[model samples]
Target: MTTAPTVRTSTPEERFVAAFELHEGHTLNGSNARIQGLRKDAIESFKQLGLPGRKDEAWKYTNIEKALRHEYRVLAGAPLDEVALENLAPFLVPGLEAHRVVLVNGRFVAALSHIGSLPEGVIVTGFAKASEAHADLVNTHFTRYADFTTDVFAALNTAFAQDGLFVYVPKNVIVETPIQVINLTTGDEDVLLNPRSLVVVEQSGSLKLVEGTHTLTEAKIFTNAVSEFFVGPNARVDHYLVEDEGANASRIHNLKAHQEADSYFSTSTITLSGDLVRNDLHFLPDAENCETHLFGLFLGKGRMHIDNHTLVDHAKPNCYSNELFKGVLDDASTGVFNGKVFVRPDAQQTNAYQSNKTIVLTEQAQMFSKPELEIYADDVKCSHGATTGQLEREAIFYLRSRGLTEERARTLLLLAFARDVLEQIKIDALREHLDARIAARFAN
Candidate 1:
């Protein structure tokens, strides 16, 4: 018999703080006044907030400290000339024809990316170049959406923000081709990466963005990424994030969006593999007649840990929002879902709904689901609920009696259960790819 390796619970604050100090001058030497000021303030916030432990209310269910037991080399973004386009074949969605953007070790590599198919007004490039070329636009919306004062990971990512993805769509223009951003981690050393993205869609503009992460090496990689989106009036944005990493990878992702009147914003998060993964998603519908939607699906096995924390703020009258998250845990894996909807006092006629469901496949598997609604408006209609249980044995037995094997019957039932959230994905190729992946995961 083999025993699992012990994890050290020591804090990694000092290591990161030292790395920041060693690289501060190099990172902020030629930046503008506003950019420099934001970096300095962000580092101070990171120092004050530090890393969260079990005592933190928001982090009570996830043990992130245990996943930080690696001696990671805090590094900045750099182009990878060694990686070729052929190396990305396995990570891409099959049969999808879209403009592809590639990032290696959190830095955008233009040589490996293909974005010529996009329209004239659409702007897609690395954050570093965008900050220099389109300084005014980047400065206006960079740190406006994703606040780092209360969240430690967001603060850290802001402090070290250098290169990632930057997308812009002009007013009244529609982008027909989907923009795919692929973030890959390679190399044999343990390291920590901070990536940032800022997307702005002007009035009446439309866009479809897809982001994914994959690990190509067996080394431990910790990725802390922050993305901000500004949806203008009558604009539409569909965002998707897919995490398909190895057991040696851990990720902390924060995405914040601000929607104007009559705008539509939706996001789907799919977690397929990882050692420890946490997603912090926030949507603010600050104007009347705005619509927001959030969906997530996670499959955990082999001691994997997945945590999702989401907040939908209904600050204006007649706004609407809906959320649904589901999980399937097997072996000794664990999952956490904490969804919150806040309706302000002036948000009259606001309609918000949230639900979380989970299926535990083994006795040792666990799931913590918390759905909350805090409504200060008397005329608001808000509801939230959670459910966690196992697959119905009667259904499985009934399928088996129809000449199907027990494993096959169970796989079919699980697929049907996940179809609700999967069907919500708008991208046909991406949805089909995920369907095949999920089927293979259960068929084995």
Candidate 2:
């Protein structure tokens, strides 16, 4: 039997690089120089920034120390399961002939993937393979949007980056079904998986993408994943990300999307469960006449903790953006929502809106919400709002008067509130599946 890698996190930042160096057969960023340089810079930045604590304004409410307080096998995992990949067939969107890309323990598994005939000019493969086949595209898009100078987690991920997912859609090609890129972390060992994906959609092209993160074992693990999307001019893209890790798992999901002129981009994040999950999503309309929408729904119970931080920057004029995030917290769970929108000086005629709503079921549950807007242009329409409270008494009374039990009425109201965001999903099959999942959560 292969011995488990013992990565002690009790020392936090002090032991990470030492542990990373001790891992056998581990090479930083492979043989690619661009990748090597990026990794070098990220490691240096991480050493300076270190791990952020509550003192940092952006991380004031969330306690990230728990992630570093334990030992994790950050370098290796046990052997792959022969049947694990086969069981993931249910994850494929129902009623659609979608291409499936699977990764186990952050390593791509080609034998388990299905790519039956793709649209012309579309490419999806593992990172190492993509780097060999489409070197130019990989050189251009890889690690472009990550500004590791500030975010330590981004820097750490870049430093430890390895084999992940790579996707490209050529100009004018419209993919019929969504592309599913999945990452599953098993209980082979107490490991930490670093998954990264680079997606580029060309001008006039359209595509739908869905990414999922799931756990299959009862081991303690951590996943630090980064995903970047580059939307070209006159293009359209819809992206949905879902994360459902084990009760003993911790994850840091970092997403950054850039939009070109006259392009349309929308993203919805659905986080169902986790021990400690922090999501950082940023949107930049870098050109004029662009449309961007951001939506998220998070549910937490027991000792689960969820933190969602989002930002939208309008760098050009005539851009429109809408942001909404909702959360349901019960037991001793903690929820945090912080959203910020910025309209640059030249971004006149920009229309931006932000709202966050939360429902706390018990007195032990806690929620912290902040919605902010900074406008440098005088002729922009911008608004922000945040509301946090329990279920409305009037609505509960009305439902009970209509012959529904109190518990049933509460469930119905909570489901109705959550469905508003779920209805925005453009894919019918995925929406229905998520609806059933939400219903099942409340059923428990």
Candidate 3:
């Protein structure tokens, strides 16, 4: 028997650092002197920490060393014409009045965005633009919600992010319409896209936001993204992330939310494409009676790999959290899930639950799942479970006995397994669209 080819090993830290240096000299008019200082500090921190390796517990299954061994060019001042924007208009959700914010190649495109009429005390704009238009708000909570010390990708995003979207919903105000953000990347050239988002919902306020990510070309590109959210007392917010990038691309997404007393937060992540993807979600319930829901669905085919890590921290009493994630792997793909729930000593009467289920369609496919619960409080209820298996042979044979083809029966069963999570999406139009997309994938 012949041996497998040896993979070359090289550090990507230098290449990423060089890219930051090239983008740092550019001029940003809205950013003040103090903001510049903070950016510099972030860059310094990123240089020291660098990219993680297999030894790191969080990144043990997902091997970054083998995935990011090549050098990527830094994108600067790329032209984003009107034609590119028009090509994406057909995919927009119909019959809904949405505030559209467009970002091309990690930079905001002002001409393509449609900032329609907004209610009073509601502010939505770019991060660089917020430096001048809303300096106090930007300064107070720029990198306050998420901890970038252990996350190298998040620090890299903060170092090179020149422009990003920022949304602030003031106290006692409700955003009637959803805010939609379209992040498109043309990876014709090898480069890295660092996108950032900061959202703050004041006390007793509510907001709903949806985001869609797509690619235009076929090239090896890296999209490192970070989103920070803060929910005040009694506030409610719903967030959704849809990934439809090309199969040749790779992405790392970090989402963190901080919830105060009596607040509610829900987030859903749907992954349909990408070669190697990792999603990290952290939720902190710092006060009493807070509620949180986390859901995810990922489909992996070919040689793709998808890794998801979620953590819920209970710091106070009487909080509840529930998490469910599902995955379907085909061909020679792989899937990884690591879900952890932590309850501190002061947190009493807390209820937390987590479950992960995966279905492998092919014998060559692989899956790894680990669900953990760490409870420090004596009076709490917590549980975790994980399951991985192939398609039920009896169910498939039953469908075949009804005169259905083998392929058709398998497709139907896969769709039935995924429909439960898809039904959880509240948006009618988006839900229907996603269902159609999943159906079409199986048909082909």
Candidate 4:
């Protein structure tokens, strides 16, 4: 009778290292040279960066210590029994027709996915498959846009980037059908997931992508996800991320994008539910005549916490960028919004705007908003503003005087307050689905 070897690990970081070592031999054995190199580099970077704490200025407002207390293991589980098409009905946006891609516990599930007819030269598949089939393309943009050296969660995600989603559109091609990725977390024990995605749109090409996260189990889940988008010259890309996880789940998402000359890139982040959620969104308009837009909406209740940090870097001349983020907090929930716009010295004729607004429904609910602008170019136009307050009593009273109940009047006012962010959604079906969801939320 021999005793099994002991895996001594204390902190979450140490446990992650141990987990990586355990999975390195089997799950990472067949990876290509470039991927292997990325994993190695990422591990070293993680070691140097470690996990952030309250001292980190960027993460000061979001306290994740309690969320990281569990001993979470990374599971490359696929074809999970609990993840069937029937079980995904609640997650799918009604009346939205699109190609569906499903991932369970960070691994792609082909059985539950549907890839419809795509235009010629447009490739959409699992990351692992793309790595093998389009090695050159994957290698060129996998770790190029999202910087892992400075971000600890990004480094951790890169170290565990075995599989997720991959999309590529060749030059001059347009994908009519939107690509919808549903990320599901289901397990009996606490698990950590790293879902990595890379999307590339070549010059003159266009694409629309939507990614949503959902939880199917009550187990504690920590998702550290990284997604990179590349818009080539004269190309356009629209992206959306919907986070509606369970109360026992926490997520850290890092989204980075690079836009070339004459390109357009827009992203909207809708955070509906989570225990602790933090989103780091960054965009670099590196060439002239590039356009970027960032929009976010977060609704927090039941002691949940949501943090949104965004940055737009104007590195070239004649670029335009705009950002708007709003939040509604109730029942002791807390929210944070920190947005920054940086204009380089050579970025002349740059136009940048940022705004953040929040409504606190209860005295216990709190909000922190910080909007900043750093313009080094004299020819640039940059502005930022933030506001946090409760719903106007006059508006609610007026509706009540019009023969409406107090609760109904309050709900209507909140819905009107959130319309700015909701109206930005280009997809009519998706927008309607979210509008209904929001209305129901306030109605209840």
Candidate 4 lDDT by residue in tens digits, 349-390 = 999999999999899999988898998999988888999999
Per-residue lDDT of model 2, residues 1-444, tens digit only: 125766543566666666555542355545476776777687788889999888987888887865666666565334666645557865666665578888877777898777667898799888767877788998888877867888788887877767778889999988878888777777566767777778899998998988888788888878888888899999999989887778978898899988999999999999888888889999899999999999899998999889999999999999999988998998899999999999999999999999999999899999999888999999999999999999999999999999999988888999998998999999888899888889878766
TM-scores for all predictions: 0.96, 0.94, 0.93, 0.96
RMSD of every prediction: 2.7, 2.7, 3.5, 3.1
Error of 2 at 18 (Å): 1.5
Across 334-403, the per-residue lDDT of candidate 1 in tens digits comes to 9999999999998999999999999999999999998989999999888899999999999999999999
Q: Which pairs clash (backbone N, Cα, C closer than 3 Å) in model 4?
A: none
Question: Candidate 3 overall Cα lDDT vs. reference?
Answer: 0.83
TM-score of 2: 0.94
Q: What's the lDDT for all of these models?
A: 0.89, 0.83, 0.83, 0.89
* TM-score: model 1 vs. ground truth: 0.96
Instruction: Return the clash pairs for model 1, or none.
Output: none
Candidate 2 contains a number of clashing pairs equal to: 0
Report the CA-based lDDT of candidate 4 relative to the real structure.
0.89
Which candidate order results from sorting by TM-score in descending order?
Answer: 4, 1, 2, 3
Give residue 403's error in model 3 in angstroms.
4.2
TM-score for candidate 3: 0.93
Model 3, span 107-135: residue lDDT tens: 77777788797779888887777766888
